[model samples]
Target: MHENVRTLLDTLELEKLEENLFRGTSPDNGWQRVFGGQVVAQALVAAQNTVAQDRHVHSLHGYFIRPGDPTIPIVYEVARLRDGGSFTTRVVTGIQHGEAIFTLSASFQRPEKGLEHQATMPKVPGPDDIIGQEELTTRILESAPDAVRHYWMRPRPIEFRPVSFEHYLTGDKLPPAQNVWVRCLSDIGDDPKLNAAVLAYLSDMTLLDTSLFAHGMSIFDRRVQAASLDHAMWFHRPFRVSEWLLYTQDSPSSSGGRGLTRGSLFSADGTLVASVAQEGLIRLRQKSQPDV
Candidate 1:
């Protein structure tokens, strides 16, 4: 396992507080708190720890409280909500500083035959044809707004390859639609569930940025303030996230200082493995003028 993946697995091994209660430590990072997806994915893992192996999580809904404290350990309290013949449900509350930092309700279902249909993946260049997000970030920071560049051009977990090299760092503020091909940086084994969870973690990283595109604002711009509020995801098919997955995202509406974004994750061969939706706080911050 990669070091980061190992850190994640260790964090999910919640310390037993009491029967059905546990506490999880935050990874040692400099973020204001735990990354939103980390808590969501970990909570789901914790919930799954108590269930049968045959059951796989198919859906999840989560809300972020105060940003999590990476310096502090999170306490997770699991509720055995329902256990039936073919379906199981669990609710996990992540607590830090005696307050609920995050909470998730996840549902798992055993494999079953069902009707199947999925929207075809959009036509896009293959991964090898596009530049990675890190490389693009470095290239764009040369002329980008300093504030935006300094904040967004930092290191990250996974590498992203947009189908076409356009609008990423150009400060062009293009349309609200974005199709990026992404995959893990390290060989993260062949486990489908782990891949799904990793995808879930990455999905929360940038969906909101799509909502800001049409407004002529970049996430790097000082006048823009964006953060995810609620996130929900649906698993559509079984696939490995270690390989290429197309994340097509769009913003349907933005108003009242908020925006809603939706996206679907598809395998390189056009299998829609997951769908995601999220709403975020899109309030603009006070502008800081650039040096003349």
Candidate 2:
């Protein structure tokens, strides 16, 4: 495993506190707020740890209640909502400093054959045709804003190979759409729940950015204040993090300071593995008055 992925797996291995509680800590990456993805993934891990191994996560609905504090540890409390012959449900609440910071409800199911169908994957350049992470980061940083560059240069559990960097390369107010090829930098063994948690982590990576494409802005844009409000995901088929997956995303609407975006993940062989949707608060900041 790559050092970064190893660090992430270590972060996900929550420490059991009570029968239904676990504690998780963040790596000292120097961010004031914890990455939303990490908390989602860790909460999923905590919930799965409390359930039978035969069940695999099929869907999750989550809400980000408050910004997480990276310097402090988070406590995840899991409640068993239901247990059926084939399906199980769990609700996980992430608490920090005695307040709820995030929450998720995940439903799991045993393996069973079923009729399946999916939309055809969009035709796009494959991973081999895209610029690798090191080169892409170097290219973008030449003119990227401080926040964007900082995020790109940092060592992450996965590497993003965007289909195109046109929007960032130039401040173009293009359509609200994006395509990026992504995968974990390394393997974390063959634990199915682990894979699901990792997927949950990745699902939050760029959905908000896509929502900003139409407005010609980004999370890096100092004039914009953006944060996820809620996130939802559904697992349709088995997937692996060690292999490339295409994340095709687009924003259908952005108005009233809230934007909604959706995406689908397809394996290299064109099987749709999962789907994700999120809405975020994307308020434009009022420009500061010029100093007198």
Candidate 3:
């Protein structure tokens, strides 16, 4: 495991607090608020703790109610909403400072035969052809703000190879759609549930940026502020995080200071694995360019 990934897992400390409650700690990854993706992943882990190993999480929907303090530990209270012979459902609330910072509803289902079909994966450059996020960050660290260098620009445990990273920043801005491949930095052993949860963690990294692209904005330029308000994910097939998977994202709508983006995940062999949707806050800060 990467040093950072180990630190992150250690910070989470997924321990049982009560019969159905799990306590998750926060790592001060230099963010004032707990990361939305971490909260989602931890909640999924907590939900998994209460279910049988044969069941797999098929879907999860969540809302970020309040900013979670990264200094405090989050108490995840899992509610057994329903349990059937073949399906199990759970609702988990991440609480800090006596308030609900995040809440999630997830459903797990036992494997069963079903009609199967999925969109074919788009042709894109393979992961080996692209540089990892850390390498990219290191090259740009000299120009970044100290805060960004220390936190936002840190090494990403997941590797992402955009279809064309150079085009987004240099060429004519394309449409909101983007295609990229992602995978874990290290082998994540044989736990499908953890792999699914890791997918939940990786899902939120760049989708909201697609909305920014729709307006010809880049977070790198600092012309706007963005934050996720809610996230929803659906697991379509079992897949390993250790291998490369394509993530295709696009934004369809933005209005009243909010933008909605959706993404689909596909295995290298063209099997659709998951779908994700998120609505995030995007506030434009008009920039003053030098007078011509």
Candidate 4:
């Protein structure tokens, strides 16, 4: 397995401190705060450990209460809310420094037959046709901004091939939508719970950036203050994170210093495996005045 992927898996494996409590740590990569996705994934893991193995997570809703301090460990407290014949519910709270930093509620259900329908996947070039992140970074290394360059240069567990690189290159005000092909760098075994957690982690990657498309800005822009306020995901079908999946995203509205974005994750074969919705803080910072 790729070292980064192994690291990611290790990060997701929380230590069972008690029956309903778990502890997780963050990678000491140079980040000011913990990634929101990591907290979400870890919290899900905590909840999953408490539920029966026969049940699989079908949906999760989370809120970011405070910025997490990456230097310390986060303690997750899971509350077993209900355990019906076919469904189970768990609520998890991520705590750090004696305060709550994040909270998530997840629902798990047993497999059962049901009527289902999904929207057709958009027709777009396959992942192989699009430029990979490494090559794209090398192509614009000298010209790209430091933030953008650093982002592409970082070693990530997941890889992405975007449908278009024009927005990142030119910062042109474009439509508030994007499509990116994503997959784990290494094959994570077909564990339903693990795959669901990984999917939740990947869902947060570019959803917020979709909102910035209309403003010709990106989260990397120093003038923009970006943070995920809340995240919600619904697992519609089983999916393997190791395989390429198309992440189609769009921002429907941006107002009151917040932007709402929605996303769908489709397997390479065009199966809609999951849906995600998130609203984030996208306030712009005022430029400083030049010294007199």
Candidate 5:
């Protein structure tokens, strides 16, 4: 595993507290607040620990109530909502400073045969055909805003390669859709819970930004304020984190200072492994600063 991925795995392995409580800490990634995906993934891990071993996470819904303090530990308290023969539900609240900063509800299911069908994967160039970060950075610098360029080029555990790079340049309103290829920097093994947790971690990478594409804006725009409000995901099939997955995303609406975006993850062979939906705070700052 990459050094960062190893760190991430350790971060996910929350410290057990009381029977129903766990504690998690943020990695020193130098961000002001904890990453939304990290909290979501950690909360899911907390929920998974309380669930039966035979059950696998099938869906999760979460809301970001407050910004996380990366400097301190987050306490996750799990509530066993319901446990049935085939499904188990858990509600997790990530607490910091004795207040609720994040909350989630996850459902797990036992293995069972069922009819299945999914939308066909869109036609796009494979990951190998796309220009990755190193090559793209050289080109992005010439046209992208300084802050936007830097944010997009910076190192991250997940490699996010957008098929359409125009949105990061000028604010020429384009379609509210994009396709990106994403995967872990190194293999994190085949543990099912770990695979699901890693997928949850990556799901929050860029959905909200895609919502701003039609308005010629980006989360990096200082004039525009943005934060994820809620996130929802459904795991349709099992998949490995080491392999490339295509994240196809689109924004269906943006109004009342919020933007809604949905994304689908497809394996190399085109099997839709997961679906995600999120809404974010995307209002413009009153006294506009640099939009970079």
Candidate 6:
């Protein structure tokens, strides 16, 4: 297994500190702050630990209250909101420095028959057809800015194969949409809860960047101050993170210093397995005082 993937799995395996409390740490990857997805995944894991094994998470909503300090361990406190006949609800708060940095509300449901319907998966080329991140970096990073180049060169647990590279290459302000193939670098097992946690982690990778597509900008751009404000996900079917999934994303609107983006995850066989939505801060700084 890839070392990065191993690290991610270990990170998600939160240590139990009390009956309804858990602790998790972020990898020392030299980032200024902890990634939002990591907190979301850890919160999910914390919630899952307190729930019945028979139930699986169907939906989760989370808010980013403050930037997480990666240098310290985050303590997750889980609150058992309700345990009903068919549904169980849990609320998790991630604390650091005695303050809440993140909060998540997840609902788990026991398997049962229900109406089946989903939006049609968009027709797109397979993962094998799209160029992987490595090739994209080797081909384009030489002339890219330091920030952009550094971001692409870093090792990650999840791999991305975007269907189109024009935005990154030419900086054309095109449509606010894109399709990228994503998968874990190694097998994360078949446990539904584990897979769901990993899926939640991967969901935050590039969804917010879709909002910048129309402006021919990216979160890596130094002029843009970007951060996820809130995230929500709904799992429609069982999925394995190790397998390839097409992440179709679009930004329906951007205004008032915020952008709203939506995404759908489809299995290799075109099964709609999950959906995600996020709103992020996209404040652009003036060029004169770039450091501010």
Candidate 2 structure quality by residue, lDDT tens digits, 1-292:
6899989989999999989999999999888899989999999999899788899999999999989999999999999999999999999999998999999999999999989788999999999998997787666666777777777777889989999887664567889999999999886766788889999999999889988888777778878888899999999998898899999999999998889999999999999999999999888877663211
The stretch of ten residues in a row with the least summed lDDT in candidate 4 is 283-292
TM-score of each: 0.89, 0.96, 0.89, 0.96, 0.96, 0.96
Q: Across residues 1-292, which tens digit of lDDT does each residue of candidate 6 receive?
A: 9999999999998999999999999999999999999999999999999999999999999999999999999999999999999999999999999999999999999999999988988999999986777777778777887876777678989998888866665567889999999999998789999999999999999889989989988887767889999999999998898999999999999998899999999999989999999999988886553321
Q: Clashes in candidate 6: how many?
A: 0
Write model 5 residue lDDT over 1-292, tens digit each, in one string.
6887888898999999999899999988789999999999999999999999999999999999999999999999999999999999999999999999999999999989899889999999999998888888787655778887778776677887788787878778889999999999998888899999999999999899999989988898877899999999999998997899999999999998899999999998999999999999999888654332
Q: Estimate, for each residue in 223-269, the C-alpha lDDT of model 3 and write its tens digit.
A: 66677889999998889988999999988988977899999999888
TM-score between model 1 and native: 0.89
Regions of candidate 2 where Cα sits further than 4 Å from its true position: 287-292
Q: Model 4 off-target regions past 4 Å?
A: 287-292
For residue 274, give model 4's deviation from the true position in Å: 0.2
Clashing pairs for model 4 are none
lDDT of 2 at 44: 93
**Model 6 error, position 69 (Å):** 0.5
In order, the Cα lDDT scores of the candidates are 0.79, 0.89, 0.81, 0.92, 0.92, 0.92
Candidate 1 local Cα displacement, residue 47, angstroms: 1.0
Clash number by candidate, in order:
2, 0, 0, 0, 0, 0
Error of 4 at 40 (Å): 0.5
Worst 10 residues of 1 by lDDT: 283-292
Error of 6 at 283 (Å): 1.0
Question: Which ten contiguous residues of candidate 6 have the minimum total lDDT?
Answer: 283-292
Q: Per-residue CA lDDT of candidate 1, range 1-292, in tens?
A: 5666566656656677787777777776677757888888778777877778888889999998778888877888889999999999999898887898788999999989999878988888878777766676766656766765655555555667766545545666678888888776677777656776777788886688888888877565567777788899999788876788899999999997788999999988889999999998888765653221
